[model samples]
Target: MSVRSLSATLALSAALVGVGVPTASARPATYELSGDAGGSKFEGIGYDARTQRYYVSETTGGEIHRGQLRSAAATEWLPGDGTDGRWTARGVTVDSRGRVYVAGGPNGIDHPGAPDLWVYDRDGRLLAALRTGVPNAFLNDLVIGPDGAAYVTNSNAPQVFRVAQEHGRWTIRTWADATATIATQTGFNLGGIVLSPDRRALVVPQGNVGKLWRFALSTGTVSAVDTGAADLVNADGLVQDGHRLWVVRNFSRVLTTLQLSSDGRTARLASATPTDPDRVLTTAKLAQGRLLLVDSKFDEPTAVPPYQVITMTPPRR
Candidate 1:
């Protein structure tokens, strides 16, 4: 239970007895921000509190773009020299020192030995190079948690892993293992993972099966973060502002948030963006008090490229 030796616990995924979740409805307004990036598949998004800027990474193009996140219309943050314009970027993270880290993989295929995690300054200057050799670790989304450790998600392996800055190389640890083989399900890929404000729990959404899982940092055990969805809802990105767990249901097309219990298990739906039937994959990012979401435009075979990033300033009632 004490994660000092990296000899973490190996407990089987629990909550197998609960087969179904009761249906419920949530209320959140859909606000669309005006901007387009040519249908790029936006993988990871983060907001800088220091500069008040929003960063979204392009999965396919390797473009880590900057954008102004405001109540009004927003524009894309074009790449820079030796910064954005010069390098291919994937999962991105802005550290406490204001350093930005991006993940680099060979476009789509397995480019082994290729450093996937890249670092940049606030001005987009390449700072550090990081690579992890976790089997099938196709880096997707990256986030610097409240404790300052960088956590990443891999789509292919469908596992949530972490990296620590030790000596110079980014020492890696297999922090989260949400393998689908344990669940007897096909699509349990952990897409986005984030820690709660208390640093006791991690809220993660699966892209294939549309489920949210809450794992305890102390116990290293996982439970159903959200049990409501029973189909291909495609839960993707996640972020937590201390208390509530905000998740983007990619296939269901809704932004939902729920409160985490003090014990770090069981996630109940608290709020959800209002959507009409047939709407889909509502991706989201939470920064400060603002929630940024995008209405994915589906162009299958090609997929949803540069999914539109929309901003909504929720009225605090």
Candidate 2:
């Protein structure tokens, strides 16, 4: 279908299904890291419940760092040795098996990696570097699907790539393409992604446009979500639990939570809580029953040393 038709359909759905109000509030705590490893530009966040570890990826050099839930120190899991000049990290996520997945891409138009996913063991050993095979793909935030598949969003493209282990070897494929609507419009499309509660579909947001969408894996269908607000500008990272989805607006400097429908097509704004205005925050994850966020500070004049991961309770309904 065309983008216009799809948008009209979505509008009808929003009107028929009904929309919910959004609430804004604030309550958070900050944890500082020990060294320069903490200062480099960081973006993604992931948590391993079994080991009680939190993982973050640096945007400057594709370095992976790990820290304990309550520790002030964070150590480098993968050093940013600049193996490839263009190598930069975006999103980091951990699976139930304790494996870590880090997204890598170019830092700018001049420097570009092959847009890959770096899979590592729990101890930070490089297990595999699976290339997305998509041209100029900015592989961003990712989520592990119910069937153990890894689905990654491409900020430069209008699609989500799926990576799954097959016969002990990992393979990558384009799970669904959001070719219509704002998918291919421009800048930072398909930023953060998460699966539905039932795992039958995926929900995603466009960073530049502040629009949310749902893609059905079974039928390759796409639909818009009624955010109630005109725009969720700078919507960067997304974390979901049960029926709630938390979206981090990097430029807005706030974390907004939305209550999603079971099908993942619709959401009502639950709350928008203020984050540290001095630090540009990106991704978030649930650790120890609290929400943890990374201070990416991507747009700051000079990155301050001893970066931090802030923890807080999700705003109440």
Candidate 3:
């Protein structure tokens, strides 16, 4: 769809969906990302609440974009095209220490010398570019754990990699392997992930099977989360506030809300709201009481410019 048609369709959908839309006075509604000549497509987004800065990753190349909460345009923070041995980037999350962690999706699968993930300090200096040592690892999305480490999801396999600095040295290891519990599928096996409100477990969605799995942080045991009757197919990025969870179904263009049990074992579907029909929002981060969603443009046959990270009010339960 053309840009004009897409905006009009989104405006109409917002009115019909009955959700609170962001007015221009409140925010710009959408934050633009710097584009590349290759028709840069984006995926994961990370927000630094402390600095009011947000980071976005370009999928076509390993470039990372940075924008501020008050700014309308993001500038390129990191260059792609094999810079730092990174050819492509995926999920991104910022640690409490202002460090940025980026997932290299399928970058290491074909090239053994390529990095599977990268870590950068607050100044955008490369700290580490290491591989998980897992074969065919498709590092998709990641979330910062309570222990001040990054837990990344492997889309090609049922595994989670823990990337952290140990004894002044950076290391990447397979922290949890759920091959027996969660079966690997054709498409993305695991996509979006979030920590439970209690901070006891990691809640992840298996997009191919439309299932939720809780990975216990203490024991590393994986169990299925009972999300009764919620069609969570294509579930991508996850955002959690207390027991409330928002699941962004990318291709389906649906934002699903669920109330989780205190222990994070079960969930009740609250609502399934339709998103803009023209964009595929891959992931989101909650910042300043609003959601900054990445409009991935993965659905477009040929993506256009003015790529954006749109803002929306949290859906009411």
Candidate 4:
């Protein structure tokens, strides 16, 4: 292998070593991404377990970066030419077949196009750009269901967009529209989302209320997940592992862990751990037992080398 490829392989091997091991005994470590020092506005994160590579999406620049675990060097893997000045990249998820689906916006009043779901191949080639016809659609985070359907959340509107293959072509439309009780948003509603263990429902947190909600897949029903006295408060990116929920509170700089009841209607606080407080972390992905986070720092002036992904062991509940 070439020198650069060899280095990446070594780093990935080290990262994979901790995948199956329990995080309760693992120590936290931070790996800085080195390459493309431009203003990326990195926000969303996704991990491809098959290749042991993590994908980070840019919010404003519309670029996708690929890096190995435990490595400081990351290459500019996908430069979505259309994303540069017009569309913006938000959340991203990679399917079992290595197909990458990216979320974008109904932003730039002058841009004049609905939000879209951009799909790409493993090589970063643009495969399809599926648009959500919803007006002012701020397509935020997304999750791929067991049946190969994509469920994406819209922070601006009280709805979820679903993309599926029909007649050999992809189609996008509103899957669920939240009713009055659960579709609340102070600034950004429904930031991060994940599917339930059984893949029958989606668990999401309201950014404004800091409360969690469950949306049934079989039925277009929405209900709040009782947290008793605790609130996810500012919940952003979320990942579900069995009965445990891992959430990122961006503004608070903390990762909150919760244990869900058997029926998936209630949750209770397990633990909350501190992350890099100075930087704003938007989303997280689980690689084996390790959790990887991307630093968006959206409002801050762009840094020289920009920010890096923070990898650590999830706090014990």
Candidate whose lDDT is highest: 3
Candidate 2 C-alpha lDDT tens digits along 224-285? 87777635788988888999888889989777878888888778887766655566878788
TM-scores vs. true structure, each candidate: 0.70, 0.85, 0.96, 0.86
Q: How do these models rank on TM-score, best leading?
A: 3, 4, 2, 1
Query: For candidate 3, which ten residues in a row score worst on lDDT?
Result: 18-27
What is the TM-score (0 to 1) of candidate 1? 0.70
Clash pairs, candidate 3, are: none
C-alpha local distance difference test of each model: 0.55, 0.74, 0.89, 0.74
Candidate 3, superposed: residue stretches over 4 Å from native:
1-17
Count of residue pairs whose backbone atoms collide, per candidate: 13, 0, 0, 0
Instruction: Provide the clash count, candidate 3.
Output: 0
RMSD to the true structure for each prediction, in A, is 11.9, 9.9, 1.8, 6.4
The 10 consecutive residues of candidate 1 with the worst lDDT sum are 4-13
lDDT of 2: 0.74
